[model samples]
Target: MVQAVPDPRRWKALALLCGAFFMVILDSAIVVVALPSIEIDLGFAPSDLQWVLSAYALTFGGLLLLGGRSADLLGRRRMFMVGLALFTAASLLCALAWSPAALIAARAFQGVGAAVLTPTALSIVTTTFEEGPERNKALGIWGALGGVGGTAGWLIGGPLTDISWEWIFLINLPIGVTALALAPRLLRESRAQGQRRGFDPLGALSATAALVLMVYAVVEAPQAGWTGAQTVGLLAASLAMFVLFTVIESRVAQPLLPLRILRSWTLVGANVTMLVFSTIAFGMPFILTLYAQQVLGYSAVEFGLSSIVFPLAVTVAAIVGQGLVLKAGFRLVATAGLTLLGIGCLYLTQVSAGGSYFGDIFLGLLVSGLGVGLTFVTCSIAALAGVDEREAGLASGLSNTTFQIGAAVGVAIVSTVAVSRTDDVVAGGGEPIVALVEGHQAGFLAATILAGIGILSALLLLRRPPVPSPDQPPLVPVAEHADD
Candidate 1:
């Protein structure tokens, strides 16, 4: 049995958790915005540049389940502090990196730390805060931190890179140190009761290898050509390994991810939604940054400032959405968010080379941000809704893993669509500028179609919110009818 966490220090614990989460989220965007500077200074090739992003994402996604399980077995507070220490040390290594290869390796280590830290942070929140308005507010703030950190990363990265690309990584040191220091005093230690249990090392290794291969294939497919033998072979291998992992998990005594959780409708729906939403949400900003700098002729700082509008809108909408969730429920709020996202993507299809930034781009960004904020918070609440305290770590891992995979897929798909369209337009004798503009517009149009499918999925799959449990404080607000 999991011990009930005391309420007196709950808010302080939440603050520490969010602080850790902010550092993780901050790194995700900061590195991307600073990439150009790093490339210029380190002489990175275009192919090698992809590794800067892929290295972190692949490792983070691959190890998330293991990280979550470790938190359960090792104690959330303990694992969280350990993760922060590793992450901070890795950040310093990243700052001091002298070569592209060195930086990539450091980033991978940093991802390991993030993977260990992230899900545990969510699990802490779930265990500490009772469900209902308080939990909703906490999750809302958690979601907002991600949005805010991502947006702020661009702003900070631009200025920091101008001073020194190293600052982007070095900045995390102080924040991590603070969180590490405060965690032991403010946070309660919790772990699964079972002892003398064996871990399924085979299952973990296989699953991690499978996901890494899959993500690598997707990330490389656009540059290598989808029909390339390397892409095809790796993708097939990924599928095979994934199948093997599933079989192993079913028979393993202590699987990294418990298969039983998939039976829960809310959990499944939430994961699916996260996968789709994250793909679009994370991918769009990458493409847009290129458009702003390479195409629109904006400086790094100017481009970062422009990028802020979307996430700022997301933060505001997330706060409002949380309040609405308390009154209207997850299903309704998520549906509305998905609908807005679809519309925002469709609006983006109207973007053109001749378009004005304020009139066309900003409006679309604001709309999309609002939709993303609303969807993220609602999906988070729904995913954890009614989850048993013992399973909170797994639940957090599952949802986050879906989002990570979805983000990788989204970037791959969008990049492929844009590149292919550009080639076609250029082959037809269109001007280079025309081809570039058309390719971007086409990509956004494709994203809109995908968002529409997600909207339909949310509407059809999710139902009314579950009632709060009397025995448990309202901290985990999962639905009563959640498939056990």
Candidate 2:
């Protein structure tokens, strides 16, 4: 059988798919900056506000594996269209929602759509492009777009929220509609060519329940007393469910998660590294935005503008990292990137209530962005490097799952630390605002620790350049032959 090349039309399809992915990723951060406005306009309690973000993330992360598997069993193009339609419809519902419950519900559905779409999108890209530098370059752009979209979300969201928070959802509608129209004309469908398997409903249920319970426990611990029955009960339940999931996976004939993938040290390390980096990357926006608005008293627009530093740096670093990986090697550049990320997080630990934005915050964001940018590309490449074409969908799903889980865990851990410290400062008779700032500083410190741990993991887990297969040509290190 002649190997199939990606249809030229698939390039356009990939672009549209990425555009949709960008919208979803961008929405995650866009809402963070608009949360205050959302709360005031929508009459949301402080306790309920977290769900505005959490609802989307929980559902998206929870259903990712199902979505990926569905793509393989069904068709990538079909799943992509279905996901886009659902996402677009949910966005409309979100824009029209008058009550907090309605908005949260809509957001959850949005997550469902995102879960369906993300893995299928990646699977499509992997299937369309051959496994080599071409795919690496494409995946590099995909990863870079995610980083860029996150930053753009805030920058655009601030201005859009000023116009109307509803505009954010409404905006995705047109783009989504355009993508849906273009998709049929441009995209080709692909799936596994062999025996079909039934969906593992039990495994899916157990895994979703485990993740949600765990995330809920962590999220609630910051608000509810950690010793409270509700917190303890949820945490206990989460642990039990996770243990149950492992047992179920081992017993099931068709496991939702193929446990064997963990045997690949490169894949395991990349997933763990992604988790750590994602945590810092996602959690920092929450901390920094708080610092800007509450501590420095910057307007939303000013804060959004300041936040641009990191994404711009990430965009630059992503391009450079891709070039470097083509020459030096993923190991060297990735280690360096992780180290920069640790340094940047550590730098932010010095930030205080009186810190200047330009002097302290901007530089920290830039350094962290560059570090994360480099690592994101390298880790993504490393994760997918040796994956078989048949197993590409599974690998992509697992990788994306780790990214989501890491983000949730990062936010939860950092938030818990900050909230605990803030409570202490408040109990000490400090001003409420001052206590809040101190809590944020403590969170950044915790984030620094997390990033430092990631660096150590990268050093310990990642090996030198991977040995090529006998049938395959020796792979040149991207960083070694950099033109620049």
Candidate 3:
């Protein structure tokens, strides 16, 4: 039997794949600091501002399963380049957007591209590196890039937005074009050998509609009244669409989301915990962005720089968490992470109108960052546990979907609550700064509740793998590589 010859360009391919992955992840976070500038420039209504973020997340999350399946049916490299072109075009549209609606629409387009790009990129990475140390190293690099991209968003967005909000989106153009040019030379084409070519666009559409409508209803609830016909009707329609998605999934020849995948209790638990975990991870930064700018009167650059502690702490702690997961299993690490998350959010509630960053925000950000790092790493390990190798791409796609969905939902919930509270306080003739502080505090409290639920999910839903005897190595040293 002859052994297979490895691709000589695998490392170069890995670099390109990781670079694209970094850009996709960066887009998710890059808009954070730029939100205020975007709102001002684009005349975005407070209620509609989140659409900039949620629109991207909704489409990204909703279409991911389809994207993954498509990559399997089509060629991974082809889909990747197509996604790259689309994403680059959409970024240009976002930068040139003249109105809120236009920007939101463009962002949704970008998400579609991301939906196609991210999973396919990960698939390519997995296929490029032979399983074992090499693959693990590639995955580790992939995962670390996600963290760095996320952290870089704040730092990069601030300076860019300081110059002009459009710069944040414009920066993607050069990177995307460079990657597109090199992809053919560096990355080989691959696909699932015997998969059917059928698609479930309806399943994807229904799910997206459900999430978009749900977020729309929540974002509008403050002004429309929670129980008003508009809110109630939209919520009902969202539910109906969700039910329709499930039905379509059940009957489809090639379902976008394979229901059987959920049978793995660990995967289910991990995804569920991840859903809540992301609510906090994505929600906190949004509220802080507003609070820092609106209440504390920090410039975009200042807020971005000061908030560096959060992601820095997250990166550092994630490195430390890798070790902890080796000692204790995912269950304990996830629980502890969430506990810390809840405590951090609870601590943040003490923030006041005139409070300083160090006195009021630094500790909470540090603690929450640590929690975010640990929870994401451990929960990811749990999510992939026990899945068959063939379905690895599907499982990874599903996990990524859960995360984006959580981001959409979390931003909706926190933004709605904060805006509503601020409106009420302002209506009562409260000082604007104080009202803003109260609103931020409310948002933090909501995040704390999310963290508490995450803690419960970790404790109750995640299964405990049997401890290996002293002779055997840890059942799996999963901490080395995490799914972002």
Identify the leading candidate in terms of lDDT.
3
Look at candidate 1 and tell me the lDDT of residue 181: 81
Query: lDDT of candidate 3?
Result: 0.82
lDDT per residue (tens digit) for residues 131-239 in model 3: 5345545554565567667767988889899999999999999999999999988887766655687888799889889988998898889999999999999999999
lDDT of 1 at 26: 80
Query: Tens digit of lDDT per residue, candidate 1, span 131-171?
Result: 66788789989988877776678888888877898999999
Q: What would the C-alpha RMSD of candidate 2 be, to one decimal place?
A: 5.3
TM-score of each: 0.92, 0.92, 0.91
Clashes of each: 8, 14, 0
Q: In model 3, what lDDT does residue 40 have?
A: 94
Candidate 1 lDDT: 0.79
Off by over 4 Å in 3: 1-11, 129-137, 464-484
Q: What is candidate 3's CA lDDT for residue 341?
A: 84
By TM-score, how accurate is candidate 3? Answer: 0.91
